[model samples]
Target: MRFFGIFCIVAILCCDLAAAESPLVVIVHRSRHSPISVEEVARIFLKKQRYWKDGAPVVPINREARSASRRVFEQYFLVRVRSDLVAYWNEQYFHGVFPPATLESDEAVKRYVGADSNAIGYIAADLVDDSVRVVHRLD
Candidate 1:
């Protein structure tokens, strides 16, 4: 019985360690050459930074609210809880600003970012390819 208990604990730890090691990557279309920062990513997602350095309008894509990736992204990148973001966006709505648009899946975000020079989005690091360049990565 003690061996079984120990095995279960080990399995749980391994699962958690795998999840923690899954890397999240921020990507932009390959054509975009400018560097980006976590602070800038936060600004773009919150609709504070409306344009890229080259004078192009910035388009930020977000994952669905309930996605695991979205939860991690919000915690590490935005540094705001869901309730606070709701209240923040409610205030921004009155001022003609809105939160970034959300895509249904990581693949959708990747495709959008890959096609648009002014677009930025985050996805699993393994999904990155030649069509997009990673601007930031969170491990």
Candidate 2:
């Protein structure tokens, strides 16, 4: 019985460690050549920065609020809780600015960013393919 309990604990720890190791990758269309900084990424997601340097409008895509990726992104990048973001968006809506459009899944976000040159989004690192370029990675 003691050995079985120890085995279960080890298995649980390994699963958690695996989850912690999977990174989130920030991605953009392959054609976007300008270097992206983390600060700029935060601004773009917050709807504070509206346009890219070439005059094209910045389109930021977000995963649904309930998604694990969204949680990780908010915790590490946005540094705000969902309720706080909701409040912020409510205020911004009054000013004619809107939050980034949210997709149902990482695949949807990847597809949208892959097709739109002005679009930027983040997804699990393992999901990244040749269709998009990775700008930054968050663990």
Candidate 3:
């Protein structure tokens, strides 16, 4: 019984450690002209930010629509899914609201957002670097 209790406690602690170490990050180009909050970041990711300081389009890149990290990001950041978010965009798209471009891979997103001054993307926090500044980390 004592050994079983100790094993359970250790397992629980490991799980807690993993959960506490969040891996999702909100990344932007090396030149993020504007300081932003998590909410504004969500707005930009949803394609609401139509322009940047240079009057360029705010390009937002995304991971797979159903990725595990994306799901968490959507819930915590965007507060919705691609489908529901699309529905939201549809309402705004008619009003001339443009949406962000979607990318399929971490490397592609990193490369694209890193090279574009008006671009932003998300990736596992471990993948963040000087090329991509981390604006937020999901926990």
Candidate 4:
């Protein structure tokens, strides 16, 4: 029983450490732009600012609320608690400005952004590749 308890604790700690170390990166279609500022990225994700400078409608994609990347994006960029975001979105819905569409996994987000010229999304930095260009990285 003692060995089992110690093993469980170690396993939990390792998982937590891995999650903390995984960097989050904001990605957009490779053809769009590179190294966009964090503030602009935040505005895009928040739906406060729409349309890329070239007159293309910005399509922001989000990971599921409970995903690790989503948590980091909400806490760091959005700067609001989940409940407050819920309320904000509710208000936005009334105004016909819905929140960004959510995908189940980072792979899906990458694929979506890669396929759409105006789409942007966030994912683990390690998952980034030539398919998408990273605009911002959050450690």
Reference-based lDDT, residue 19, model 4: 48
Most accurate candidate by TM-score: 1
User: What is the per-residue lDDT of model 3 for residues 92-135, given as tens digits with 9 covering 90 to 100?
Assistant: 78888656667755667888878988788887666677888887
Q: For candidate 3, which ten residues in a row score worst on lDDT?
A: 13-22
lDDT of each: 0.86, 0.86, 0.73, 0.84
Residue runs of model 3 more than 4 Å from their true location after superposition: 1-22, 81-83, 93-98
Sliding window of 10 residues with minimal summed lDDT for model 4 = 12-21
lDDT of 2 by residue, 1-139 (tens): 9999999879855644444467989999999878999889989999999999999999999887766677788788888887898999999999998879998767788999999999999887887898899999985
Off by over 4 Å in 4: 1-20
1 or 4: which has the higher lDDT?
1
Count of clashing pairs, candidate 3: 0
On a 0 to 100 scale, what is the lDDT of residue 48 in model 2? 91
- Which runs of model 1 end up more than 4 angstroms from their true locations? 1-21
Candidate 3 displacement at residue 89 in angstroms: 3.1
Can you write out model 4's per-residue Cα lDDT over 1-139, one digit (the tens) per residue? 9999999879855654464478988899999864577788778888988988888899999987766678888898888898989998899999998889999778889999999999999888887889899877787
Give me the overall lDDT of model 3.
0.73
How do all models score by TM-score? 0.83, 0.81, 0.71, 0.82
lDDT of 1: 0.86
